[model samples]
Target: MKQTPNVIVIEDNDDDFEALKFAFEEDGAPGLDIERCTTGPEAEHALDRLRDRAEISREDRVLIILDLRLPGLSGFDLLKTMRHDSRLRRIPVVILSSSSNQSDAIESYTAGANAYIRKPRNFDEYVDMVGSFRTFWTGCAELPVLG
Candidate 1:
């Protein structure tokens, strides 16, 4: 069977999501498929997609990029659930919010986010940041899962 890298991006902003998609394509992430969920409820449902045997039980790596502030359940709460869930606890979570507040970073870590990354200010920087994410999830770094 063909390998599919499980990548999830929980973001509400359309522009940012598009930017991330564009950057990943440019970076050449093989077998990388990004699933976008615009709201907290949407993200929750998206997580259900990962529960499928076709998606989860193939020795694939699952990485989640989450925005800290989201409508409905909120990213912080989502992180908590992801960390606690038996089915989802193994996936690594990266907080890619625009929030520069230390509290947001601290709270995300406190809630079990694997990484906290502040959004860049400029377009070039944003692209660079996306490249970094590609590197982290797809390149040399080894992903660690709780489950």
Candidate 2:
């Protein structure tokens, strides 16, 4: 059986998280195992635990959606740390932030982000964005096996 894709969303805003959840549901991809981390440190600890898992299947896939403006450590700091870590480096990290600065996007890619997406302004846009994200990341992209 194909395992459900695991998605770790590191976002500090509750409203954005709720909107994302609603969008995923609207996209009809309820099979995704989505987890939320309110701060960068929380996500870092969670990723560390996931990386330390004893056994992982070849089909296991994990994705991280990070926000640039976070409470502790900052998203850029976390991205830099993840790139340096052998195990975490394999997991794909996407930046989903409200920032529209060109410098932020450039920095995100330079720091090791797989993709950088700006947050949608409306609920309909959110749904469309989530749908596209689901179709690409889960259906089309070949995710790295995680342990």
Candidate 3:
């Protein structure tokens, strides 16, 4: 049986995380194993654990939703680290941030982020954005198999 994709959300703010979770739930994206990491270091450790899992199979998929401004280790640095690790490089990373800076977007892509998305201003917009996101990432896009 194929395992549902795991979504690792790396965010520091509790409100933002709750909003995202609510949005996904409202979007009716069931079967997704959503996990959260409050800090960049925590995310890094979790990713390393995933990578080192001996039982991991090719059917396992992991998608990272990263925030740019983290408590420690920054998103850019984490992206760079992940890109350099062969075990982690294939996993897709999407940047979800509040910054509208073009430089941040550019830097994210340059550092190996698969996509960059700004946070929506309203709850309705967030729901709509998550709906589209779920449709594309979970339904339309073909993600790489980890491990």
Candidate 4:
């Protein structure tokens, strides 16, 4: 079996997604694979594919970095549905949105977001945060990986 912790970025911003992908690659975080899905439905379908391939398991550390404002199924809706799903409820979900509203932050945590991060306005700050994320998730955290 071959597995590593996986991160799924669920945001519609193509530019943001590409930037993040590049940043992660630049950070040289090995043993981690990054995946992207532009929409909630697309993410769901991708998750299904992963499951079919036996890539995601009950012990997999599948982190979801989501944007609150989406075109169709909003991040809130996706969070709610994921929480209700038995198979995916345990996966860590982090809200990474540009919204600065307190209510959005409150609702995200209340609705079971593991972490709520405001999208950084500065480019350097954004990269720094992603780098910090890599450090924490890959270094400090004892994430699940396949044998």
TM-score of each: 0.87, 0.94, 0.94, 0.85
Question: What is the Cα root-mean-square deviation between model 3 and the actual structure?
Answer: 1.8
Model 4 worst lDDT run, 10 consecutive residues: 50-59
Writing each residue's lDDT as its tens digit, candidate 2 over 56-124 gives: 555668899999999987999999998998878888899999999999999999999999999999899
Question: How well does candidate 1 score on lDDT at residue 16?
Answer: 79
Report the lDDT of model 4 for residue 58. 54
Q: List, residue by residue over 27-93, the lDDT tens digit for candidate 1.
A: 7767787888899999988777666642446576678999977888899999998778777877889
How many residue pairs clash per model? 0, 0, 0, 0
- Report the lDDT tens digits of candidate 4 across residue range 48-84: 7655544444555677789987876789988888787
Q: So what's the TM-score on candidate 2?
A: 0.94
Model 4, position 105, has a per-residue lDDT of: 95
Q: What is the lDDT of residue 99 in candidate 4?
A: 88
Location of the lowest summed lDDT over 10 successive residues in candidate 1: 138-147
Return the candidate ranking by TM-score, descending.
Answer: 3, 2, 1, 4
Predicted structure 3, TM vs. truth: 0.94
Q: RMSD in angstroms, candidate 4?
A: 3.1
Cα displacement (Å) at residue 69, model 1: 1.4
Q: Report the Cα lDDT for candidate 3.
A: 0.88
- TM-score: the better of candidates 1 and 3: 3
Q: Give candidate 3 regions above 4 Å deviation.
A: 1-3
RMSD of 2: 1.7
